[model samples]
Target: MIQRKIPSAEEAEKLKALGLAVINKEAEAVAALAGRINGNFAQACCHMLACEGRIVVTGMGKSGHIGGKIAATLASTGSPAFFVHPGEANHGDLGMITGKDVVLAMSNSGETAELLTILPIIKRLGVPLIALTGNPASNLAREADVHIDISVAHEACPLNLAPTSSTTATLAMGDALAVALLEARGFTELDFARSHPGGSLGRRLLLHISDIMHTGSEVPVVREQAQLRDALIEMTNKGLGMTAVVDARGRLTGIYTDGDLRRTLDREIDIHGCRVRDVMHTGCKTATPDMLAAQALQIMQENKINALLIVDRQQRLTGAINMHDLLRAGVV
Candidate 1:
């Protein structure tokens, strides 16, 4: 078997130092982001926001990889966006773009032949082009509607051949553009959640109280004058560990929970004689049907309670939700 040689302490230290130097270079490149946030960046955001169509991102090789990530960020953050390989444009994928769309083209040198081949078609279609390039004087930058210069003083590689700092800078610029557009459009967290419905954020933002609450016969409710024994029975039958106490006119007055039962037992109150209104907790927090389930979870956490009753504007008990419901629905 071939033996592997271990690096000496001096060589190991040199490797670590090199890695740190690379990180510093990338950090400096990202720091330069503030200076690039000028009129050009603002114009890019405005073009994207005013476009009635999708933002089509195109690039080649390493730039393409960064472009794809930028497109994903834009799409998830409320801007409609997608990536198309510049090489595929002449192969019929060009139909994906239209006059209403905004094209974001990325290239460090900005003279990639495949991208240059599609510029005429993009211009003829009246689609605005935004170029992210290291060479501001490059043809791609000159022909575009907006140019985001992502030039770096040097590559992280010692030889300045590999795309290290340049790629990092390009990715940072893409993130900057996405965030700028997100703010310009007043995009909210809820909007981001809607686009990411398969993720946890989607479940928290989209799931509302009405979607996972118990209603009708599933709701554990009892008249305020009902005995503690009756309320306990309703709680048991509904399996929510709690019951809503309403007045004779069907308006919510208070709630009785397992904790309330323990407190009553401590007081030595007779379950058969004590009315629900006498033992139940009044002003128990309630939620509206349209309230986000995550918001309801926050209320439960802040109040240190396990259940929440849902009421209409008229204070009529419409539904009930508990910790278990929020847990099962992934709202917690």
Candidate 2:
């Protein structure tokens, strides 16, 4: 094992101070970007919005890394975008770009050799070129149809040689573009969920009660005229810690739960002789099959319940779900 040496008090304080300095410098760089979101930024957005095809993002070095993330953000937020390495674009990767696409090039110096090498080809394709660069006066920016200035006063690096504050500023600029486009397109949470179905937010927004609930024979249920013992057996067999009490027409009249059992025991009631209707609680909270699992979770939490009945609009029990079911479904 490679053990790390613990820093001394003075060293630790110095390390913390250095970290804080980096954060403050990067924050200031990002804050400065607000001023850069002017006519040129709007022009860039307009071009991207009008594009019928994808946003082809190309960059070199650290800017390339930032461009990849920007592409992903744009792709997930209603704008179709993908990252293409500038160096690779010079090889055979230029074929990936189409005449219908918009090219977004990132270069801190506005003169990355690899990116500049492909500028003529991009122009030949007759695509709108949006350049994000620190040097607005440089060649790439001058050639671009719209130039976004991501310039930072200073880098967070002590030597001012590494890409730190500049990268942070660039990333912030990318996020600003993506969010503006999202709002302009009227993108909703459902749209975001559809794009990210494998994530937690997608699980919360897209999972429905009908998708996870115990249905038909799996639902713990009993007739209103059934004995309390029968309801208990149903609850035990279904393992939902509760049972639905229904009428002869199969419409839910009430619910019988462990809490009700406790109350019946407190009253010294005869469990074998008592009817389910005599002890069940009426108007128990119920959910529709189309209700979001996230909504079901909220209802259970607010009512301090561990299970819920799924019913049709006519109050007929269709399914049931317990806290465990929600937990298993990753909605909890």
Candidate 3:
């Protein structure tokens, strides 16, 4: 076995203090951005809101990383947007920008050579240019239609050279812009879920009981007049640990579950002689086919039940689901 060396107490404390210092600096930088959300920021948002084409985000190096995330947030929040690397733009990706689009360029120094090379072309396209940079007086900022200052007082890096506090402030500013546009566009949680259908939030919001429930022949069901042994057979065949008990009209009357079977055995009742209705529990919790699966999960949890029967307005048994079904569907 390989043994790992542990830091001395003094070294551990020093490392912790350094980490805390970095966090404090970054926090201060983000806090300072709240004051800068003034006219320039509003102008930038207006340009983006009025854009007929996608919001094209461009940056180099660390700024590019932040730009990609900002573009994704904007896209997911209902503002059509994408990231275009400035380096690639200079090498033929410049064709990606069009006159109807809005360009959001980021550079801490506002002087990335790759970004500067494509500035004139972006200008000629007549698209609105929004600049985010630490240096307000730099050429890119001066040439931009609207500039939002992302400057920070100090770098968290000990040498004050690496992009630390500046990157954090830039990311925070991007978030503010995305959220502002999201609110302005009246983007709702449903809109966000539509864009993220494969995500957990989407599953919780969009997936209905009908989508995951076992329907028709797959539903474990037994008539109220069925013998207890017959209900047990249905449960065993369907493998949902329960069987919905219905009347002659096919409307649900109650449910007979494995638990009920156990209670019947404990009471020394005759499974062959007793009817399912005699041992079935009525007033069972039920759900509609259109009910959200997440809500179904909640119903099962609150009722302390493992399975649920889905019915329509007529109370006819349409489908059935259990906790394992929810777990398999990622709704658990």
Go through the candidates in order and give the clash count of each. Answer: 0, 0, 0
lDDT of 3 by residue, 88-171 (tens): 898899999988999999999999999899999999999999999999999999999999999999999989999999999999
Runs in model 3 deviating more than 4 A are 1-3, 262-270
Residues 156-255, candidate 2: write the lDDT tens digits: 9999989999999999999999999999999999999999999988999999999999998999999999999999999999899999998888898999
Worst 10 residues of 2 by lDDT: 244-253
Give a tens-digit lDDT track for model 1, residues 191-217.
888888988899999999999999999
| Cand. 1 Cα-lDDT | 0.92
Model 1 spans > 4 angstroms off: 1-15
TM-scores of all models?
A: 0.89, 0.97, 0.92
Report every candidate's CA lDDT: 0.92, 0.95, 0.95
Error of 3 at 177 (Å): 0.9
